[model samples]
Target: MSSSNEKRALSPDPAVAAPVGEVAVSVVEAPVAKKAKIEDDGKTGEEVQTETQEVKIDARDARDHGIARVKAEFRVPKSDYTVTDTVPSRDNDDESELNGREDTSRRQKRERGQNKNRKFGKAHDVIRLCEAIKDGGVCSHGDQCKYEHDLSKYIASKPEDLSGTCPVYEAIGYCPAGVKCRWMYSHWSKESNKSLVDEAKKAAAGREMNRIDRSEQLLLQRKKFPTPKSDLILPYLESVKEDNIARNGGNGGVPMTNEERADNAATYIEAPIKPGEKKRLNYSHAKILSPLTTVGNLPFRRLCREFGANVTYSEMALALPLLQGTKPEWALPRTHTDEIGGFGVQIAAPKPWQAIKATEALVEYCEVSAGGLSEINLNCGCPIDLVYRSGAGSALLDAQTKMLRMLKGMNAVSGEVPITVKLRMGTRDKTPIAKKLVQRLVREGDVAAITLHGRSRQQRYTRLADWQYISETAQIARDTFHEVEDKNKDGPERAPVWFIGNGDCYSWKDWWDAVDNYNVDSVMIARGALIKPWIFEEIDAKQYLDKTATERLEMIKRFAHLGLEHWGSDEYGINNCRRFLCEFLSFSCRYVPVGILETLPPRLQDRPEKWKGRNELETLLGSGDYRDWIKISEMVLGPCHENFEFQPKHKSNAYEQG
Candidate 1:
């Protein structure tokens, strides 16, 4: 078994024994509970025993109490359940339903982890309004349209308006959902049967960029979208591959002579574009939010931006889906107005052709004139099993020659949009290959930047990021750059490739340490940003801010409001917002309040034991239970639908009952 799995298999301390099959072993030693002492009553002269209540201790306090390790817990028990009752029993109906397993027997036998087949059903209105009626535009179908034409009937049948004003209308001066909006009463007139619009606000509202036009999408779907640049670059890449094969004795198993090799080199075609010609990128000391999958949606990016994230990347979109003109894939590149100057579109491809074409499409559609794309990032570090098995993501690390070709082709057709690559240490744990890759990246690949996530594909988040290895690699990249520059003194001036280190950077100290000590240009934050959206602010202040529970809730409210504006103010939108909110909370709840922390900088892996917050609201915000996350969502997005369900992507998020 792998070290990570072995770590999980180890049992907790027997002395502090929890219920069978419920205890999760912590790497950190458990803090010994203080013993209660007997006290004498002054008036009665009778001895009285003092009751022992739960005591809260911070990192410092835990250490002061002779504890050698931080008392951390990945899975937390609900408020009603004692620490011993952390994980719920299979017999619990509520737990089973929330876990998406209705049968108790199935729940008992099944191992806890990702809910791969979880279903999300959209909420639909009983009487759907016609697009013509909603937008005041003519419908081509006219009377043939199945949608309701009578605004009165549609409004009457619509569910009662949600409380409070419409966030979308409040922000942009008009609700796109119109009368069908959940909060329509805030912007609708009963007598006039018309939706109100703030003409001035609507006109002044900043439009989101990179929305794929219907015509462009249609062209892509028909495989007619012009990829003139890719057409040229792909043939050149293939010719180079053929030449390499010939030189390596592929010509009837006979190796080419020196004369033949020279001839082959002379016949090699020059690339359409050079590294120096690409747009310059300066990410020095920048705080970047990593391209998270489902949790890193636009609303969350917007929140991080408000909190001072220097750069944000879109979720990794698959090249196949993007080329096929799938709406979901197309949506990955969509950026909010605030993200225009700092946004990057990350794509994953298994082949050179796919990478080249995908880059061309992104550059063509998401042009600078249309919002803009800072860079095209090739994702080579995703550790998901499905992506890895498909010969993409981290699998690229194993296929370096193919990977280098993909990068080269991407650079050729990317125009001014610089192509960057995100990578891992290697495919397997303890086998670091990035140091060697860095030399090749500088000498051959014309990438704008290189981001090395300090973990191997096999390590995942099971171990701490290897910043020492990342530092060594960064140094190698610098030395390689100098060597290459000296070798090509007469060549065009190229920008120095920025090196970014990612993984386990949870605090300002972590960020600064990577920059100051590790020789990295920047640190890409993933889980850290999810847990504390205001982490950038902390970096700026160079100190931890003890955010009140109210302040945190307000942030949650802002995210929900932004989600509504981006997704829509309709039932489906609300459901999406609620579900994503829960997803965010799943990570956010892992944050141990700085105010309660006895230590200055908290490590990402140091999971705190069950501890109360300064207040009830703070405790709720720090809850590990998915149900509490829903309660927090209800406070903002309103109650979820009866069929609404959420299962955390990590198995450790749920606990078993005692």
Candidate 2:
């Protein structure tokens, strides 16, 4: 919104707020919400009808107040009641039976119209609350909302819903739909026109809401998971012309040139893992949710070796494929001896049987010290609708019954590997029942830990994460678990399990801030590392260090070789390997150029393209042979290929629709 517009809205009497700027007219009608939002295919959001609303403002009042207040409004046209769909409309001159009923219907329709208009005009409070709830929708980062307006659709769909209360209000202390709340449109709108000006008395203060930290003696009889968190080298040689201009002043005294502007716009990402920590994780009551998505197919065991990541999880593996034992994709990648020795394999199961049967064979593969893994991670966090509708991923959040069934079955066989579930905020907006669900999972389901993804399934990855709510949930976890501990003092220290945070981790600074700011155990990464592989190394080094073109090429070469070694040497396999390796290179190679790059230890971002390959990439880039990448994947995953064909299992963005 424009500053002037905001100023007008703050007018003492919003009705008098001013309208500014040229108004935009839309011909497309508002969409109506389909009752059945999801079907066999997938979830297609609601559809609403739209009718034009011509709002007229009093020029004098608006100019004084400085903002515009909605005057008149339009509604998306309602479906016509006709003879074919329902009964014949009174428009038909059918005499006898229909005559009297037509008049009655007319009266009812008039009354409904009056109620709707009155409701829309007064729709503010509940609508604001609904707005808050929608605003609270998860962003890639946490839930400290800085936005003023989010989730406009829910509000825009309903013309009169803005005035009243709804279920969302009761659950979240506010509504998100604004004036469009269901209650607002329902015929129960209320408005208070007069107040006694505080009875001529002064206003008084009130107590603030208190947030108590309650992590004492908790035992929610649940399982837990381990959570964990780097940079870039440039490929080009220094750009001397740009460098000189940046150092001196620019032409016409512009702060930056077009070239500089282009460079500034390029996207960058940080590493996923925080390295150089003081100790290894205590996995006694912890499960590792891995192989993390930092560096593609980068093994958990290797991460443990490099950064003391005591526990590691396999990337989410499909239960059906893994159970079939023919899974070659990384989404359902297998765990090696080293990783299994440290942590239990995480399984993404849509049904209870998948969780049930997989646990049986999975346990045999794990060889932990006698008792085995600390916990088995149930992948309830996947947002992919493919898994959700079947009671897997975040979809599990909506189906409490199915979730309980899956957890119960998994718990039955969890001799050494306790069953734990990871869930997002809920299936959609206003579903704060995650706390309630967590309670159920602990009490009836008997799971171990509840790692809450601070987003709702509705969010996918669009909005900011709600950290405040995560902390609130954490406090709830502590309170619930602690009470259980007090009741059952003999049960091991009533450990409150652990609360893990995810999303928007771009740098060590972000990781430290989250830990210090939110008291989370660990965080998971996916896209952040896709653009920067050296983040872990940077964390361990403790200081910012830029890598030169030559240094980065070496890392690239090493990664290529690792890929080749892991996949093997066949032409087709190696080419596929090279393409994937190049994709990684394309992103990771983008470091800050010149002046910015020079801020660190080495100077490389400014370097020219000729400086790209350490030895020379002219041969490698055009050759299309990735003997180098396979070698790198091999070093990371270990040897493979009898027919000289490279095969890698770990993968993401798997739809590959084309």
Candidate 3:
């Protein structure tokens, strides 16, 4: 029998064991929580079908308060419900359904976009008259071909190439789509009956494999993704499991005493790394970007990198999917060519088995030697309902022992790759447990870094982050790290765990203040980065930039160009680019220009009153309407496809679209 599955000789007395399932919190009946007051338009509210708010503000009072407070206000426009051309509206007959209703449905639902259900376009029955077909051979279909078989007929029907050079062909030397691609004429030479392919690029293509490189294709195809030490670690985990079963009288739900738990953990878990094996990460004062879902793709990370972000993380990949050899999950680890050393791949897993296996796969499939990643981050702070429901994201914060086991298992399997974690304050508002959690993380998790987002899971994005609590927790983390360091003096010299503060960091002032006053190793920006990707630039310069609308447009244009390059310049790619571009604009539009803002440091919670920009483009940039976002994307990506639809992730500011 395997060491892990072997029956223990001595079973512990059942009387001493409690339920091993996480310590269940008592469900006390509590009064219904009252809703917080609406501070901004981003709050939940319906379009006033029978009324519109009219405000009168004194210019002198506005200048004094830094915000225009309502001097006199009344509801107007009681006749018809206003609706945009792009947004669907209720018919006049159905207007009564909207009367006196809470209209919780007004918040826009999340969008998966064109890329989610993408399929390659239909392939021609007979191959086109390319050089390969011209070599006196039948088309790949051989017989029963529907397309024109004669080269002359095919050549005659082909359209002329008006769209300059094929950007993909020019860079890669070969067009994989060949004649089927819309831009075929750009690369094809009718006179020579050949492609004007670059020899150097052709040779380079043969050498590159993987998304980032072509040479690793063989390794990937063979499913050779395995960490060298995974075998050792897997058995150890099994032994731990066996011990737990033996000690708990075969019940996985039976909880052991602290001593019993420690004894089992010590038997299986080794130090995260050897004396010199840990990878050192310099996150101190780093301009770090959060791993924003959907919005944080490779092209966007490249854009952020160009704009001066020192560190960028991939969108969180689920562990089970990664272990199952899923392409989509694997793709999450693919980084930009430029993000060689500071790119981290974040993963979410509920159990040790998933965590360990996924970590092993990442270490094996994406080697740091191949510029695959810098670190593996455990995402424990995501408050999204879907993630939270999976007992992964913020749920890990509630299951402290489960979290510790998962982290230890991940570290053991990840080989040299340092492990980091992102955390929220706690699951509930009344209980802020991050400080206590930090002490536990220091003692058992063996993590290389910890990032604390200063909010409870319940708060999500409703209120401004409590930076004071973040500061307090950071101080606690620092103290705990010192204590752990002193205690582990005789052991391997692992790198000091870096502590980063994340939440509502929109400007250079916010970042610097957190690092300077809160004593955090660094600050991570999420919505702030999406709104103004160049916030890193501002941090580097240590000053707020009064970027003109034209300058901001240039940034958008750069994103469009980069998007086309990364996603490819084909129709499918163009549509995906436009979709993602719109997603970006949804956040980017929230930036109220620094020059026009009354306050020196703009509060993310404050909503601007109806105001025109210094320029038309600036006004367009700050528009809250989702259709305006599509309009801005059209400026660069060209008009979105007729079938295209965009839904902002933020429901609070979304227009009604069914």
Candidate 4:
């Protein structure tokens, strides 16, 4: 090699450094050939060349750079094409232009001529009538000379007036005498003849016959009880799952343990109270709560479901939480397959967009695989100061039109889910308008079911639930819908929606009493389940078992296990579980009484005398201290001892709302 050529080969190489999390760069090269001693292009298509191309570096810092796409030509065989797609033609101008023009023309014509057709037609009809009166004034109003000669001016003045005017007499063309003349033209207005006859003929048409459209109308409105529809998910007694349970992870919707299915004869469900007997009113769905984010308290929710409590609602999830992808809050409506038998997720939003977004979020997450959400409940029941002031929750009753809009928004995105609603009676005047509010929801909102708490915002939970008024309201609701079917017979379709009663319900007797005496469809159980997780079992058992202290301890243990398995043993979750478990104990402890109240005041939740003493509560917990409640909570919830401590949820009202 020449000295000058050798000098060029010894220069240092320049290569970019590797990225933080990237593949190493490769120094690939082509074979080097001896120098070509030749012309630039006699043989253009074929050339012997060895080119040194720079490597394609994958430097992570390039992420901050802007991209500019440059076109490059390529000619490859058809087989080399990875994908082939047919392209649509871009030359359909006339079709698109004609469509746009037609739309614009239609709109302009509607604005300029369509709405004015009535006025224009009326003018033309009068002109024709005037001509008729001029040639032959057939008058039924041959009058007593005041404006006796002129009925035409009166007819023109009152367009729909049919009885007293001549169509031709502009002011009065004489003939002042009183008589029925063919020329005075008076008995009826000409415009009525022009349109009324046509309208009258249309009304004369009718259905060949009318029969009681049972499918079209629910019998509860005005007839007898409705026969149940087939194919509905059967409500099995809350059977135990000991045999079906696996030591393996994931429930897989298989909760029936082998022992449970086999022991079906072993009193799996307590017997139900017969209708018409004296019963507790505290077993109905009441104390409507917001489906607050993060699921309020899972340990409490599980306890309610495990005992076969009637109604369970999820925390009220915000519309924005789902739409904007906020963490955790977006997952508030999450539920399980076993829960769908009696589950409702109440969603809240101040706008139509939120309702749409929230309903979509529910559909995506609340599937059978994730959590089978049974009902999509709109949260129009919250009475909190902040929520009420925001024009959501109970405040929605004031704007029926807006309420309809939100319901429609939810329905649009709900897919196959039934849209249920939870609402307060009203902001005020609970009784009189109860019927009206229900009618509006039924007619305009198209709700599957409605759960009305018996108090208004003014009353809060301070006053007693006016049961008779709620009963009357529900009766009125039934009657009003009965009249609607009779009116809009051929307009559309309808469905039989269940009217669930809600309020202070805490015992088995309250449920049976509400159903038989007052005639309600179903009852919701809330604080009743909270105070006594096993209240459902006791209800099913016919007579109160008073649950031996040992049984109570067993439940506390199971609840703790479910809580830990769900919340995990992380620091945050352990503390959260502890706080909620304590809150639950504060409630459950209220159920274990030293003696039975031959006549307990309706709901046990209403009166905690059942388990009220510091010592009595301890005895109930199988111990004489509150700390035992935490220890029981811990045993089931896994080792949450060193990591977290339990906290109380209710105010120090001492004996107030548990």
Candidate 5:
């Protein structure tokens, strides 16, 4: 038989039955609730009681203990606990439990190293300029040089039948790849062992390909990019020196007095660009795409452009790496010829010096008219753990003073290029500080635009973004900008700083609602753009698009073609396209068929249950498995690498079962 103490131990709350001094331990279990039916009265909707069922307690020894005696005398009332059976249906209950709660611990770790494929063989093992037949110079190493000295030997080694024309040779006139390229036979002549017989010679005559002309190589060679007439470097350095003196003495190395501090402030020089001369970018009513970290490659942005995205941003590049002239980081700023007019390069920096120098280098290398860079945006909203740990990304939200300094320095050095900032609600959840931050940015940041993502760092993607707060903060931005305009009336005329809101804009309806209600200049989309690349088209039509599986497949094929063009049609480029395609599929597969949804304008957070598509193609397109995504990629780009392993960034409905 069980004692009273044993019965009390099962209760969720010990205060209900335990004496003042008695201690009780509770067993945690999934709560069960009695169902309630709603019977709408003609006058009012009300819940009418139908019948009461006996509570089923899973007490193992209830019969032996005669639980009826304990229940009759000292029953734990049902009123003590709130009912949780308000779930409308079992499907909804299941969806609510799974939505935004996916586990991605394994996938996150493997995400960084997945793009490790590189072409084999030494790229530099070719005939040098000094040894070239045209140069008419002999190699100092002679036979000891690793590269082929005889032009005849190099031509004889090439395959008799050529595959295709060398893309690099076709572009720049000379083939830097030289003997290493598989398609060397097509570019090189069968009769002549020289670099080219006709086409290559003509192209080479037009322009010479210098193998040592890489961006990083120039940095290592101590070459500086051209400086603007209105250089800010001197003023910035002087300001830093004055600040150091004010805080920690001038010649004596002691703290200065209040009068000395005032004198320093009075003597400080400002590096402000003349208002009429500063560059401007039009973001108003612009269909802008958010800068995706990995998936937002050049080909993908070009695809978005064709679909209707007007203003596009490059994937975020780190400032330190850009300053060091890293190859991969510099590649981030390279845009396709088609995107030249509307592209903006986004950069991440933790310090003012890093930001200013990186911006200056970018401006010099990629001019507004030539390099496709319309604006420079500072990324302050990245939430990845690595970025935050480096005192960059969302970590800047806590370091507002430093963020302002970085922005101002970047603006001063950018020269004819506008500066922008992307921010989040705040660092922590339920503690929104973007409203106040916007006011400060308007007053001192000198930014051309500000983008506020509606979610905090703590929220990640767990909950739906708070658009209401976004609208409120947007109003604050509008008022603050006006206030700044009034204060600057006596000074140089300034352009209106655009305020763009980003988050959870999945459908045309959501986009319209946000723009109409929030009063923001425009909206920037991230996941929604991936899920449905044609979202901009829908926004124009003001309706939901039900793109068929065949249409979607065609879009994927276009993406592959563009990838081949940008990355190359070679084996390495094909594999690179396949990898990025799979990363894109990680978000694309989450899209539920608009035809199957019972509700209009599907929500981003809604997790659909297991369901089959109308056809095999649709089923495959809607698949959440990374393997299925690979199969889809294979349909367009041939077989995958045997060693290639893919894990989706997020666990989708199909992977949930695993």
Candidate 6:
């Protein structure tokens, strides 16, 4: 009974017919005026027809009409849309429906944090060779050793040698990994089954510095390592604190008894060395690299050094672990020959005693090394929840007196190795306290240098760093230094404290601008260097170098090469290198090609819309996909082992399911 217009409305429109492979069919009844037919009684009648027609709705149109249509080629089935939740799978062919495609949708549930519980599988070798046996020494455990001792059996089951010269052997003239090296074919002699070594070259190679011997580590673990200076300084600091409290009318305003005064006087001891006597450092206009965690391993620091970073700090180490002589924590201070003159060790501690003991131990162990410690930096700026919750890192911002006490004790114990501190603007985003702290640091801290990151603990890389505030604090420090210098004119002259500013420094201009206009001695780069390792080179040249994709790949190859040299060429070492390499790539991928950018001097916060690169290699280098980073790693380190798995520390890189 429907009219012609109604039937036409229900029918598919030819103008908006669906494209190929996207048609939908529907059945409908319509009155079709068939030729008037004569019935048995000779009466004329019209016929009603039922027909099925393809709906022919465009996929785009269907989406507009609240229908989900996912393309086959753009599917990402295993995508993790939120930090804690995986994307739900679709039951039908519409599996490619983009999960959290809208910016708001993506941001609604996304949590900003690091990847948790990442799986880094152990060595692929079922029978790991014993180090003693591999070094041609008898195992301490003899026949009951858990590790494989038979060299022939290990070699028989070893994976095929990687196709390249052993980088470590080439650099140092000896392969420490020996039979276990993935590139063993390059350094091993099949005829004699002996590893080849260039004795002359080996003899000339400079040894890696800051290494603690096993006996020394054991001494520390047994609490037998001597900390004579810390032992004296800790009690002196405690007595000074108590005297200050008593002078301030604490303890019910009770005056010190003669016995108490005598006890305090006996405990008091002067520092063996003074701040004026410490080894002086010149940080003025230096291109420094920040002490990054996770990504700032030894190999990465070496890479940045090659790119012209003048000063580099070790990754932030925990003071308690260092005091305990844990191998992993002790390993952070190990330095390459190239890092000697400009290297610093950064550590975090919750209390003065811990910081003092840790500083004493590091100075005692590492001070005699070639070109000894440039400075020992106390890390008070780290904003991670783990460090903050432990009353360390940025937690010190809320407890200024405790931080100052710790720094003072650290200075007392750290012989000629001068102490420094890295700090944030404040614990909170709105209220900054560094300017006031600068005055106290000049008067009381006796720190050799100060580096202030312009962001607060609460901000946590969410906003642009307040350089104006950093500049204000730097001026305060400068003024305070002058005041201290005037007061100490008749006393032993101390070296001026260097002030370095850090944050959002991504280019040559950023570096020079802070030094020229912001009143900072220098700027320390973190994510900037990770994004472009050659940023220091740019600062020197004062111009941007549009590196070709091949050149970038060469840099990656150099990183892998250096990684193998530092980490070794064993299976475990290769995987370790791969994991860190991927971590580097996760940050590196944020870089947009200068050629593709519509403007000059790319901003670090500017996230470019999806765009193609000039070449496939360039595109791959700029891929957000972690798998592509793995592919890039394979290009340098050879095929990934079957057991190798990598999850990027950042959640942004997990968008691609693979």
**Better by TM-score, candidate 5 or 1:** 1
Compose the digit string of candidate 1's lDDT tens values, residues 1-658.
1111111112222243323433333222223534324335322222223223233443234444322232233223443333222234323647645554333222233246766665565687788888777744456898789988888788789777888899999999989887778999898877666778899999988767898999999998999998888887787678667777866768654555678667665654555557787668889988899999999999999999999998999999999889999999999898988887789999998888998999999988985655469999999999999999999999999999999999988888887788899999998986889999989998884798999999999998876889999999999999999888898899888789999999999888788878999989999999999999898976775545556678889899999999999999888889889989999998888877654554445777775656666667877998876667888999998877655766656544643321
Off by over 4 Å in 4: 1-299, 368-371, 429-432, 488-493, 570-572, 592-598, 601-645, 654-658
lDDT of all predictions: 0.78, 0.43, 0.68, 0.47, 0.66, 0.78
Tell me the TM-score of model 4: 0.51
Q: Residue 135 lDDT in model 2?
A: 25
For all predictions, the C-alpha RMSD in Å is 10.6, 34.6, 15.9, 36.6, 16.9, 17.0
Task: Give the TM-score (vs. native) of candidate 5.
Answer: 0.70
Backbone clash pairs for candidate 1 read: 72-607, 85-658, 87-655, 87-656, 87-657, 88-655, 88-656, 88-657
- List the candidates ranked by lDDT, beginning with the highest: 1, 6, 3, 5, 4, 2
> Model 3: residues >4 Å from true position, as ranges?
1-86, 89-186, 198-228, 238-276, 650-658
lDDT of 4 at 144: 31
Model 5 / residue 331 / CA error / Å: 0.9
Poorest stretch of ten by lDDT in candidate 2: 222-231
Cα lDDT tens digits, model 5, 410-507, are 77777778888999999999788999999998877478889999999998776778888888888888888788778778987777788999999988
TM-score of 1: 0.84
Q: Write one digit per residue (lDDT tens) for candidate 3, span 607-627.
A: 555455665777688776666
| Residue 557 displacement in candidate 6 (angstroms) | 0.9
lDDT for model 2, please: 0.43
TM-score of each: 0.84, 0.46, 0.73, 0.51, 0.70, 0.82
Q: In angstroms, how far off is 22's CA in candidate 2?
A: 57
Model 4 RMSD, rounded to 1 decimal: 36.6
Model 4 global lDDT (CA atoms, 0 to 1) = 0.47
lDDT tens per residue, model 2, 1-658? 1111111111112133234522222122112223435444564443434343422222232222322112122111223221111222223425513542233334221101111121101112222322233323334433554433444554454333223223333323332332333343332222421111222222231111111112210110111111110002111112323444555766534355678656753432222211111112343322233344324453323333343344555566676664554335323333433343455457778776666656654554444344235467787778876777766777777677667766665555544456667878887867667778776665552565667777888888665677777767766776776666677776434234656666655444444555667756665433444444444443443323334444445565555544433343223334444545644643343333111211112211122221122223321331211233344434432342222332222221111100
